[model samples]
Target: MSDKEELYCIPSRYRKTENLHIVFWLVKDLCWVMLWKPLGLIMIIPTLGAALLITWQTRAIKSELLHNVAVVFWITANAYWMLSEFYSTDDSLRYYAVIPFSLGIITIGYYYLGLFSKKVR
Candidate 1:
């Protein structure tokens, strides 16, 4: 197999960094969904950390550029949501926030489709 092909192949064992990445995101998302009210908008701290760590983990992958961009949008969306929750009552800001969130999701979908789809075999 070519180096590029090998690089794209899924690893047999999950790396510690990868596991941490998953755990971080899980905590982040759960906190955002469940604890946001009690946490009083401070939840973005851990979520931002999770996003940064996930972006760091993607650096080892072949599709790092796409992953990084997606993470950026994800972080931006989270920030917008947090800001709207804590500070902004502007309805327009809420509507604008969807753009980055949707873009982030779409980029992640594209990355998975392009690199990890079963059809790629």
Candidate 2:
């Protein structure tokens, strides 16, 4: 990173929310692992909400925005996958998580393509 880029600072309040977001995501996944269907499903609300909030907070920086948007897609896919298994619908629905997973991949790919391109400014 350049000197200017290295100087970029994330506000403390936003950083706190980002950290909280991780906690919520972990709780959601843990509930899923323990097969606590009710709490696991409920946890999706806060987990996804936090991800959305983080994505919004980082909207000003292209790299951060792209990565955050990918995270939103990831949580969405994860939530859907978890719900599918919880409902015993995995046979027909789990694979659908690929949609959002692929979206996340595409977003990252777009970010990298722009970053690596040799186009003149």
Candidate 3:
């Protein structure tokens, strides 16, 4: 087995799909941020789709469990932020949105630090 396959255990095909999904996800977020008013939050649709695809790709590899969970948390965070942006009339929902957002960030950081930071031995 190749070194990467030994570490990640995911097929190259799924890895490529995951990489593409991540790229699309970032682009979607960029669009959402740049055109928030003019796009009227429509970018979330594609972002959500990309997030879902990423989560799905993570499912094939057991080593990616934490990353999968982080992606799920990210999706929840995005949902909360979207709700706060489009539907909330009070400050409470906006405040609530921060919880998931922070958790998502922490979890993503944990996943990267715990997994990606380790050198192959």
Candidate 4:
């Protein structure tokens, strides 16, 4: 750390929401791990909703926005995977979780590439 180093700060309100979002996400996953089908199914609402809100709030910050958007996709994939396990008559739908998972990877890749390009200039 140095005096010349740049600092990035998020508003307390946003931070609080982000913290609460973690709780929601954890609860969702815990429900999944515990195999509480009905409660787990319902937890996706707040989990995904908070991810969306975080993405929207950080839209002005390109790097943050990119990461947050990926989080949204991650949650989507997680929820889909959980649902597949819960509602499936067979074990096939879980394989499709790759779709959203891949999207999250691509989003992160794009962010790193963009950062690298900026440094190259």
Instruction: Indicate the worst ten consecutive residues by lDDT in candidate 4.
Output: 86-95
Model 3: per-residue Cα lDDT over 1-121, one tens digit each: 7766645356788677777766756665665466454343655566566666666767665446566666767766765665576666776776676677778678778766766767642
lDDT string for model 2 (1-121, tens) is: 7767767689999999999999999999999999999999999999999889989989999999999999999999999999889897448889999999999999999998888784643
Which parts of model 4 are misplaced by more than 4 Å?
none
Q: Report lDDT (CA) for all predictions.
A: 0.66, 0.93, 0.64, 0.95
lDDT of 4 by residue, 1-121 (tens): 9999989999999999899999999999999999999999899999999999999999999999999999998999999999999889778879899999999999999999989999999
TM-score of 2: 0.91
Model 1 TM-score? 0.52
Judged by TM-score, which candidate is best? 4
TM-score of 3: 0.55
Pairs that collide in candidate 1 are none
What TM-score goes with each of the models? 0.52, 0.91, 0.55, 0.96
> Could you give candidate 1's per-residue lDDT for residues 3-118 as a string of tens digits?
66644543434355456655655655665666455453555566566566656656677477577778778777866775665566676776678999899889889988877776
The lDDT leader among the candidates is 4
Q: Each model's number of backbone clashes?
A: 0, 0, 0, 0
* Candidate 4 displacement at residue 120 in angstroms: 1.7
**Residue 107 of model 4: what lDDT?**
100
